[model samples]
Target: MSEEKERQAANEWKVGPVAFISLLVAILFFSGLFMKIDGMKWLSAFDFTTLGGTFGTMKEPAKNTFLGAGGVSAKAGFLFALSLVPTVMLALGCLEIFSHYGAIRAAHKLLTPFLKPLLGIPGLTGLALITDLQSTDAGAALSKELYDQKQITKKELVIMGAWQYSGAGLINNYFAIGSALFAALTAPVIIPLVLMFVLKFVGALFVRFVLNVVYKEDFRNEQ
Candidate 1:
């Protein structure tokens, strides 16, 4: 490749050692892998669930959760959202630190190449995809902005939407909402989250393939 092309390629995939290290640290901290290591109980300091702590069990007959014990309506929904604030803030705060050291940039570099083959989308759309893990609304807004800016076609938006809609706000939602059911789960915390994330890819790819084949003529100009 030419010198200029080489430089551009280098820039495209640039992830410094510190950024990569930060990513690894963030993973280890949140993975729940070190929360119970025999004599190293202090490792809970690095664990998310351990540090985010648990809510008091509901004792108002049957005991499902602390959220009004299976209560319904807008009031119950508001309380449920209120309960999630602390954990979400704690998780996002730690993520912000990692991001300050460039974890997001590192993730973007590693994830960009898969966009085209996996989701039939541009590499630049990686941010919106990653953002969905934290906040569905932000990710949706970003995706819409991309479409409005003509960076991604309508077909690409639909495929991306399929991906996000399936698990929407995966990380935060899983930790905030799904964590309530963790007591009944036999598998570790990370396992189900991993499955959900993998399914997002599977779902998006299916949409992309359908768009290319069954709806081929509609996206004829997109190619």
Candidate 2:
């Protein structure tokens, strides 16, 4: 009985059934296997086209309207929201795989030095944060996951949120619409892009100061 007890204690750190299943689910879903399997066909119910159409219809004016400004806004918002789905899935899916393989722990050790001073978040969270710069939805989703796991506190969330929203999806959105949107600005568009990146970090710092100084929420101690 003593030997059995010792073995149980030794295996305590091994990956559990739930974690294994989570990793599997992340892999299957992201790889599109779930959609292919008839048993999991229901998962594909998250139809972006239908969702976008619904939003466009709902935003149509009360009076007779055929895709006017409101409809356009709705479509744009839908597409924008849809654009984030893949990034969020891919990032979170990779996170699950990394977590299962203990890569997150390794990454945390390596990233702590740089991320500690800049983001005030755990080294493990660096993956999500970087993904946020490219896709706000992915970043925000990953942030929520980290918070739910108790890896970060509410104060840290606020700081990351500020940084994310200030200039989230910077690269994708810029290349998608920057040219036509700022045609008159010409070469000066580069200035705004650079400023946006700078301001995101600045906003993060401001939030950190507010939380650390005013609220006395010290993340260094929390970690």
Candidate 3:
């Protein structure tokens, strides 16, 4: 091969060390392999049943026999929020690694074409947005990491957060928690999930308009 050709081949972009690290982090996170690791087991130690029981068992303040409204509310709030702590911590840690390792930048260029028009955010945001549809805490945590890194502007943050709030946990919420309603009804489960997912994007458009035009926030620095 010619010298010039050899130089081009050597410099041509291929998966690098950072990309490998980022890929490993992503796989560990999404596959729940991190949770299985001995050192990381505490991250998944939270008990959903116990958290739910706190609210289920809560009652109005009564005489000495009852813990009262204050106690009930305190326990409920603490447990509910505590259940999400693991997700937030895990996502933040994994995303920081991904960001430092160049995963976000590698994904940005390819995703920009599609995500920009629909969400007014960079392509890198897709990972969090998709994860949100399964787990809201993890998604929000990832978005926060992006915002902190200044990869996304304030406007993009708000728009994406709104999208996530609307239907980010669709699969889990509908198939698991929402199964009570979906199973009892005659309607196909896909109907509500699909409807909610579409509406989420629609809501993103409105939010983008409000932030971009109404508020006049600049999101031109997306990276």
Top candidate when judged by lDDT against the true structure: 1
Question: In candidate 3, residue 27 scores what lDDT?
Answer: 42
lDDT on C-alpha atoms for all candidate structures: 0.75, 0.64, 0.68
Q: Find the candidate with the highest TM-score and give its number.
A: 3
lDDT of 2 by residue, 1-223 (tens): 9999999956643455554454444333333323334676666543221122222345536543444445566776787667657766766776776577655555465567877788786666665665665556667888899899888878778877888888676765675567677867756777988988898888989888888888784555665
Measured with C-alpha atoms, the lDDT of residue 202 in candidate 3 is 93
TM-scores, each model vs. reference: 0.56, 0.57, 0.64
Tens digits of per-residue lDDT for model 1 on 169-211? 7887787789899999999999999999999999998888898
Q: Pairs clashing in candidate 2?
A: none
lDDT of 3 by residue, 1-223 (tens): 6999988855543447776567545544453323334665565433221122222333533532234434466676777677778667766666676766766655564567988988888878876876686677778888887788777888889989989999666765676678778657777768877889899999999988887777773655543
Q: Model 2, which residues run further than 4 Å from truth? A: 1-87, 101-103, 181-191, 217-223
Candidate 3 segments whose C-alpha is farther than 4 A from its true place: 1-70, 73-76, 97-102, 184-187, 217-223
